[model samples]
Target: MPARLPYAYKYLRAKKKFPHVWCPGCGIGIVMGSIIRAIDSLGWDLDDILMVSGIGCTSRMPVYVDFNTLHTTHGRALAFGTGAKMANPKLKVLAVMGDGDSMAIGGNHIIHASRRNMDITAIIVNNNNYGMTGGQFSPTTPQGAKTSTTPYGMIEPDFDICKLTEAAGANFVARGDVYHVIELDGMIKKALSGSGFRVVEALAPCPTNFGRANRQGDAVNMMELLKDNTINIAQASKLSKEKTEGKTVRGIFVDRDEIGYLERYEELCDRVLSEVKK
Candidate 1:
């Protein structure tokens, strides 16, 4: 028999749930493993960790993980996670959202959450299209990429998720690819270690829908494309935009100290209470 999972049984649901819903050659599994490994490395108490997700392929993550999970409404994972964090500042809130879930319908929540500097770690799995919803062209779908909804080709520009989060005021923001598991894991660990709103955009491949439609060959080919088309942010800085066109830049874009929402709220409450007593 194949060796068992590296994680303890407590970290997963019943074995019956094994053989996840993701299709063959899906990179979401690799992203999931990186997440589990990041949490394990942190040595956090499972009970204190709350995994939240919105509707999409990546959203299905919380269902399999054995932590305190909340599978919420579509494009609202961050909104719910924000409330959860504010209610119990002790909880480690981790939100897993797909590109469509995070950037499209949920875009407003993401920006506001970052602006408030909420203490939540968000992992956005960008497969370039809406993998779960008929492989539709999402907000992050590259310009001129063909999808089920864009048979001719998409005409809109794609949003750089890392840049969006950083500009929105997230204290920590980074990008990683499923093809680079080690680097992905390290970035997740770093995001988890930081306070205030943080985001890690993980580029995953949806071979069945996105790959086939885009003529990207099979899953292996898709992975290779991800590896070859991406450049580290450090190296990208030295090159002109023309030279970096069509390249997905990956690396920590922003990391700095900021006052988290909960901290600020608590201070305000204390001040108000003292003044009332006086």
Candidate 2:
């Protein structure tokens, strides 16, 4: 039998209530495990953490974790998380969303949230399809990939989530696939520990939806693809875009420390209060 982890490791307040509703062989479990472990490593109290999720398979993550959670409507997690952070700046706000939920319907909110640099962490689980409603094509689906909506093949290009977040002024940005569970966990911990808007885009496998439809092979094969196709950020910089064709650039893409939106607001509030007292 496998050795069990210590109480602090697996004895999170919500463990017994979890093992969640996600399907077997789904990558969401791996992502959730990493996030939960990272939260444990941070030694953050469940009461101090708030998990906000939008509609989708990945959105169900907040439901399992024993945090103060909000299961919001589709594409609204960013807005809700932003409001929550603005209201209680001390709270550790995490918005969990899926590719279709974040990049498609929620795309506008994501760009603006990064622009605002709110004190919130956005965890985007990119499975490259509309996994819940159906295996429809999504904004992150690779070019020429087939989906229920795209019987032939997807012709549109996929979104480079990390690049987009960084370009939009997110203070911290990172990318890791489900295949790199430990790496993904570390990245999540880093994002949570950082101030300001941080985005971690996790490339996960949707075997039931994306994989079966695209003939993308089994779960293990999908993970192997993650291992084979991903190149480190440093190596990616050395290669031309064409030279690194078909490669997914992994690792910490960007991390720049700056005052988060809430911190700035507090400073302004202090100034106003002092002036009023004067």
Candidate 3:
């Protein structure tokens, strides 16, 4: 008989959901495993966690996990997650989104969430295209890349999600790649443990769509490219700008304590109640 699955396997839904719908060589499955590993390492009870997602290939992750899951509308996962966080401050809310789902249509919501410093975690799996609907160029699609919407080549510059989140006042912000599962797992764990708004941008590959359209080879080739094009933040600091040009810098960009939205709201309520008593 084959060896049993790891303890984390218990967290998955029934065996019927086994063999996920993701295409062969897609990095989404790897990212999902990293999330499960992160949650397991933290030792948090499943009941205390809520997995939320919007409509996209990556957003489908919540359906496979056995946590309190919410599959919200397109580009509205963070909005729903914010409401859930406010309703129960103690709940550990995690919003999983695709590059298009979070950075394109939901851009406003994500930035506002960061500005508010709400205690919630968002994991953005950036595959550079709208993998679910079609191979359409997303906000994070690199310049000069080809997609269904950009057959001539993408002219718009990509948004650096980690920097965007950091600038918006997120308490924790980091970047990781599917090619580096160990590091990705660590970043997720750290994000989960953090307070206030946290965002972990995971660079993944849409082999079926983006890869084929761009002629980026197969999934393995795409992953190798990701590994080659990335540098850790610490190492990047020592390199000259010219040397690091066009490379993805992966690592924690921001981590600091701040008063979260829920705490501030509760404090305000308490103060008002005391003034009324006076």
TM-score of 1: 0.95
Estimate candidate 3's alpha-carbon lDDT, on a 0 to 1 scale: 0.92
Better of 1 and 2 by TM-score: 1
For model 3, state the Cα shift of residue 231 in Å. Answer: 0.6
Runs in model 2 lying further than 4 Å from the true structure: 1-19, 235-243
- How well does candidate 3 match the true structure in TM-score terms? 0.96
Clashing pairs in 1: none
lDDT of 3 by residue, 1-278 (tens): 44887786778998688778798988888888998999998998999999999999999999899999999999999899999989888889999999999999999999999999988999999999999887899999989999999989999999989889999999999999999899999999999997899999999889899999989899889999999999999999999999999898999989989988888999999999999999
**Sort order, lDDT high to low:** 3, 1, 2
Steric clash pairs (candidate 2): none
Report residue 206 deviation for candidate 1 (angstroms): 0.7
Clashes of each: 0, 0, 0
> Please, what is the whole-model Cα lDDT of each candidate in the order they appear?
0.92, 0.88, 0.92
Winning candidate number (TM-score):
3
For every candidate structure, what is the RMSD over all alpha carbons to the true structure, in angstroms? 2.0, 2.5, 1.4
How well does each candidate superpose onto the true structure, as a TM-score?
0.95, 0.92, 0.96
Candidate 2 local lDDT, 1-278, one digit each (tens): 55876534442454465566676678988888888889888888888999999999999887666788999999999999999888887789999999999988999999999998988899999999998887999899888999999899999999988889999999999999899888899999999998989999999888888989878788888888889888878888998999889888889978889888887888999999999999
